[model samples]
Target chain A: MKMKCRQFFEEFGVTRMIAVGFFLAIAIAVPVLHLNTLTLYSQALTRMAMNGVLVLTMVPIMVCGAGMNFALPIGIICGLIGGLISMNMNLQGFTGFFASILFSLPFSLVMGYLYGLLMNRVKGSEMMIATYVGFAVISAMCIVWLFVPIDNLVLRMQMGRGLRKDVVLTDFWAGILDDLCPVTIGGLTIPLGTFLFLFLMCFLVYLYMHSKTGIMMRAAGQNPGLAAANGINVDRMRIWGITLSTVLGAIGILVYAQSYGFMQFYESPKMMSFSAVAAVLLGGASNKRASIFNVIFGVMVFQGILTLSMPVANVLLPESNISDIVRMIISNGIILYALGKGSGKK
Target chain B: MKTIKQFFSENLVVIFFALLCLGAYLIAGQAPYVVVSDLINRVMRNSILVLALIIPIMAGMGLNFGIVVGAMSAQAAIILITHWRMTGMAGIVVALLVCTVISVICGYLLGMLFNKTRGQEMITGMIAGYFGNGIYLLIFLVLFGTVIPFWDEELSIRSGIGIKDTLKMIDGMKGAMDNVWKLQLSQVLIAVFVLYTLYMAYCIVKRGRENRSAVKISVIKWLIWGAALAAVLLIPSVSAVVTRCKIPMITLFFVILVSVLCQFITSTKLGQDFRSVGMDIGIAEASGINVNRIRILATIFSTVIASWGQLAFLQNMGTFSTYTAQQNVGTFSIAALLVGGASIDKATVRQAFIGVVLFQLLFLLAPSAGTKIFNDTQVGEYFRTVISNGVIAVALVLHALNKNRKKAAQADSI
Candidate 1:
């Protein structure tokens, strides 16, 4: 009886630990909540909506068995370039949104294709190489950013420098889609427009993956050699998987930028991999599998923790990024623990 | 004539690195001589730390990304020691003890992680470092100041509950070791390097003599080298460097210990178990080896080393960019090791030294040189960062290509 009890505790201990973390967070938040419940609630919701799509992007890659998209840095850079071009072209309103998505697709596709090819060849070391390629691409893009001409006087550097790292998404399709159906209730504003678009994307992804091609992808992920033996072109499947993921990643960042209000560059997209990976991990996604549900749940819970940390601590402690620190610990700790499991069944 | 061709082909990596350096030097523009001197000195100072990355590669695990764990723990120890205001050698000694304990824990964890995922140990370890780095950030940033309530009004920000990014933790505690005997950078570099050389020489000498006494001498040489490395670490300078861009003497000792220990593992029966596990876990198990234990041990060693590396790096920088420190460290460091001519299935200590020197130099010079040549420092900086990433990409692609071809060839043979 005691042994079984010990085993049960060990099995569900992670859930308990997280529950404790939440408990502690609320304990600290009570006083702050009493003072400014209205303000805190709204802020938390805003953070969740902003970070949701980015978290969602981690799903397909995990499903395809490519592990966490540490290579997310690449997709982010592509999205940044895509967004910049759309704004610079002066495609106002819906045209700009479509244009940015259009502009980003080819780059994201090509990058993803190349990344997939490399991952296919590596067979086992995909995660690590994905990270390197991601960094390399970002680094290369940094150089390109300096040289990419910006003839738009408004878009050009203030001091005749190259494109500023943080370009305003205010112009063109800046918040066009985002503002479509924003709902303000109880002083908490929800970006219904973005949430809908994001939801639609998720639904499409879910439906598409439930088809035949997705089954092959899942198969390739589970046992590549077996899939190969069964005459499924594993490499091509991976390429397709990556292409879809990258496309989603491009959109993910766009949703993120529109909601967040600005596009920060250079190192801004650098740690996208870690964050996306972290969120998915929080949702109980592991190295080989994840779901859209995991993406949503993870982002909500993770961002909730992040949003609550600062004010709660600040009511007494004064620093705001305390939540960020906690978020970092939980995300990576989950990843580490997940990875440490001998079978890595998740 | 033969020599020239041999040099060009066989030493292509080195040749390319040298040419790149010269190109960077010309374009790097004029910095203050002192600053330039100081930077190079920093390069030399950190060389030992970088060199410590080699042995694990020799044992075929690629880059020791988890060495950051060891480095970080070492810095933590140093931080606590300095905070307590322990002076001179005593502080160094106690700090080392702390690093050792932290290293053991970190190493054991890394070793176990690597053990399970044997073939992809490098990537696994890289992630391990990133994960650990987050914990490090969380501890230093949030918990230390608020939850734990450790107080030193000087170190804490006006808004309590978080340690400042840069703490003058070692302000007066600087160069507490350098006062023992004045040592120049040349002497320090040369002395540390000679130990590596002597060990190599002893290896060669053992091969030549083939006598039992000669083998004994090799062991003695290792003992002597250990002593020498410790001496180099402890030599007192007139003024100690607190955030001075000098060599991290303490970090070097930790790396050396880890590397030697790794080398020892490879040379012993236990090492054989590790190698067998790497080659074929099933076969190793069948041969009565504890495969799981070996894998676990490998992971632990890697983790401890990583922590040590991180600790050293943090102390030297003396600041924390909580968000991104550990994110790409594994990739960059691994890229550097590869760029230095280390390969996946094969790597060596020499490769580690060469990689660190070349990679760091390129990293240093790229921004300056790229800017001067391209007339934009951002371009240079970006290019450098990208290239480090690119080199790894290229190396990995090459590895994949080679591995596939080799498999194809084997298939054909079969």
Candidate 2:
């Protein structure tokens, strides 16, 4: 029994253990702090579904050995462009949401290919370079956002030529997924449509991973030399992996924006990659290997902690952004732990 | 002509930035004196932080983004001294001592972490920086008034549970170094020239006694530098600008001291170890150098210097946003260093100084240039962000490409 317990701890990983422990702590704290448990659970579920795809974006890149997709803002920016175009054309509801995804596909594909090429060049230093690339793209887009030529008065700033910092989506596709088939039971609400969408993406990704191309990509990532010896075209596999991750990122942001009821521009997307990276890591993904299970499990625990911690922290501290502080701690702490684990070779 | 072309190609990054600075300056249409004074102030404030990056890069750590941890330590020290009501140079000294202790501890732990994440130190350091910030926030925000029993109306929020967003430095702490021994820019320049001549004369004499051939080269270099200084003084408009600006002598002295120290450290045995480790870990380890220990030492050195640099920076600024002040230190400093032509595996004090000037000059000019060209100040701010991040990204890509070429060349040769 003692040996089994030790073995379980060893295989569970410290990051996931801590994250699980923290999640449980927050879960217990919620009712004790006199917060609405049912409301918190509903919000947590909504958050999990909303951020699910973004967290899912990590698996392919990690599997294909490009490291964490720290340049998530690249795909995110592409999505924003697509969303802006759709909004400009005054598309609404599911049509608007899907149109945004469609418009974003071409951009994400091209950008992802180019980004993959860049990653191929900087083989070992992808994460650091990807981070700066993301930063550069975000800042460059700050200038681009100023003169995007989107004519929607609703999206654009009232007094300026630029888009507003937060473009409201109420008239468009706000809660389009969440409200699609929300189920309420015992005062707990479930965003069924969002969950279904998330699961669909997860299933597609799972199928792709089990396919021939996906297996080749994973083999290439696991050992590029061996894959190249086997004539696997490792570089191309990586590009495919990155392109797929970028597409998911673009889709993820649209889902996030719709659920949050606003599309945040400029610097807001800067740190989004870190949280997604952390969430995937928290769900038991290593530096070089991740899965659909990690995506689903990680988002739930990570976003659950985020949702539950806010009100609990507010109640405990009273008038402080202690929740943001906690978030910075937890997300970054998990990332640091995973990075320090040294490529998950064990 | 070939030599000139070689120089341009070799110094492409620096030359490119120099041109960008010149273009921005012209577009902004600022008075030379104003630009000169602002550049001087910025260089003095920021150069040390840029210089602090050199040791870690020498040790092959590739841009110590965890210097934010050092900056935080300095802030913590400053906050403590302010709370204690320590004032004047004594206060500054107390803060420095406190900062040194805290940063050394932080750097040591950071070094250990870097050891575990060897190949991915830069990204690890970046994440660790965020993690450190989280802990720092927790201390000031939650642990301070509640667990630690710290309280002051001015320092704490109204709820008395956390520190406020911005903290004003006590009057004596502000300008503590800059106000001491101020000199006109022209005077400072002439003084520096005289000092340079004296040093050159001593070098020549020593070399003459030794009958070394290098004395002539030293003399020629001295003459060229003297001529350059004379030409600047001889130009009436430049002279007027120089005379109009006041040099913070003490602050300038500290910056000079750091550069000299950096130069001196590189010639030492430990510096050679840093170079070997940075160049090739296997060879360095084979050669009996404890690569990990040396890397840790390099990190400690960097973190300590960065703490002092942040001290110099905050003292000059007088007021700082408590939570957000250290956020951009690593980014701006790394960007400045790279702009000066330093690479991931190599950096120099000269590059650090040059990068600080060029980076700060562009920063000073960009907004005005943006306002002039685009009629939007926000455009200029965005442009600055783009340039800073874009430069680093370009540098990283170029470095990676260079490494790939080198690796391919080796593979072909093999």
For all predictions in the order shown, the interface RMSD in Å is 2.4, 1.3
Tell me the spans in candidate 1 whose CA falls farther than 4 Å from its real position: A1-32, A225-231, A341-346, B1-10, B29-40, B145-149, B169-172, B177-276, B295-332, B404-414
Tens-place lDDT per residue, model 1, B152-232, is 766666666555666554653454433333444545556756767776776766584757776677668777866765574
Give the whole-model CA lDDT for all candidates, comma-separated. Answer: 0.68, 0.92
- Please provide, for model 2 over A218-285, each residue's C-alpha lDDT reduced to its tens digit, 9 standing for 90 to 100: 99988899999999999999999999999999999999999999999989999999999999988888
Give the residue spans of candidate 2 off by over 4 A.
A344-346, B208-228
RMSD values, in order shown = 6.8, 1.7
| TM per candidate | 0.83, 0.97
Which ten residues in a row are the worst by lDDT in model 2 chain A? A337-346
- Model 2 achieves a DockQ score of 0.78
**For residues A211-267, what per-residue lDDT tens digits would candidate 1 score against the true structure?**
999888888888888999999888788788877888888877887887677877776
* Top lDDT prediction, candidate number: 2
Error of 1 at B207 (Å): 11
